[model samples]
Target chain A: DTAVSQTPKYLVTQMGNDKSIKCEQNLGHDTMYWYKQDSKKFLKIMFSYNNKELIINETVPNRFSPKSPDKAHLNLHINSLELGDSAVYFCASSQDRQSEQFFGPGTRLTVL
Target chain B: AQSVAQPEDQVNVAEGNPLTVKCTYSVSGNPYLFWYVQYPNRGLQFLLKYITGDNLVKGSYGFEAEFNKSQTSFHLKKPSALVSDSALYFCAVRARYNDYKLSFGAGTTVTVRA
Candidate 1:
């Protein structure tokens, strides 16, 4: 079974368009995170949610918003997507704040 | 603030040879170190972690890491590397007091040739 899964493996949209990526985890984890990997392969955490509660909000732009409808799911919505948004976004989940994370197959987002 | 650094951008090794990827970290308090590997078009996979206990931690796929508090380093090693082991490796560090944020290094690409 896939512990962590992400939908829309590839997203190609025009500039200024809006897009959303869905993520779900069956690991029964309490914490979920969204990370962005740039072209240079630098990974950075953008947002983190614990038990559906926002815990860590990094210095990300307001255009990007993360929503957790339930503890098992976390989704990312980007408004006014720009060329800079072209990168792979990863969704990860952990049992708790101090546990090892399981990551899902990343969604490759391309903003043309 | 906690951070990790992977000085080597790439490491090439022959199949059945030993492999090593260097990593160093900086954090205020005790660090929770982790190693993750990523294949092309795939997400990062957890290899091992060091929370507290033995300095030498063994992980999945014949991989292990040594945690050195004095040097603030957690380097990943594999005794016999396979061609399939060629991928990108990341070293992450999280402070004990910090909530749930992991600071990842720039990443090192390992190329294991048969």
Candidate 2:
């Protein structure tokens, strides 16, 4: 069974549209994170949540927001998507602050 | 600021031969080190981690890493390579303290030829 899973492996839409990526973890983790992998293969953290409470918010744009209804789910919603927003988004979960994170298959977002 | 470095852009090895992907880290105080692998069209998979334990740590899929305190390095190594093991590897590091977000390396591509 997949420990962490994300919905819609691939997303395609036009610029100025709104999109959301859903994530779920069955590993009973208290912390969840969102990472963006650019075309150059560099991964950067955008946000992190612990037990449905937002923790880390790097200098992400205001268009990007994350909501965790419960500990097991953290979803990312991006409004007014632009061409620069196109990238692979990954969701990860960890048992706690210092544990190794389990990642879900990435969602490739494409904006035209 | 904590950071990780994967010096090699790519590492090539033949099947049945040993392989190594180098990784170095910089962090204040104690550090939590991690190694992850990623295949094409997939997310990064947890390989192993070093958190206040022995210098050498082992993880899934026949992989292990050595954490050298003096050198500030955590390198992943395997005794034998397989073609199926070819993928992108990333090294990450975090401070031992709380709310220590992980910092990842640029990544190294490993190509194992059969």
Name the best candidate (by DockQ): 1
- Leading candidate by lDDT: 1
lDDT of 1 at A74: 100
Q: Tens digits of per-residue lDDT for model 2 on A1-112?
A: 8999998899999999999999999999999999999998999999999888888999999999999999999999999999999999999999988788999999999999
| Cand. 2 TM to true fold | 0.97
Expressed as tens digits, the lDDT of each residue in A1-112 for candidate 1 is 8999998999999999999999999989999999999999899999999999999999999999999999999999999999999999999999986789999999999988
**What are the per-model numbers of colliding residue pairs?**
0, 0
Off by over 4 Å in 2: none
lDDT of 2 by residue, B1-114 (tens): 899999999999999999999999999898999999999998998999999778999998899999999999999999998999999999999987646499999999999998
Q: What TM-score, over all chains together, does every model reach?
A: 0.98, 0.97
Question: Which residue pairs come into collision in candidate 1?
Answer: none
Candidate 2, residue B34: CA error in Å? 0.4
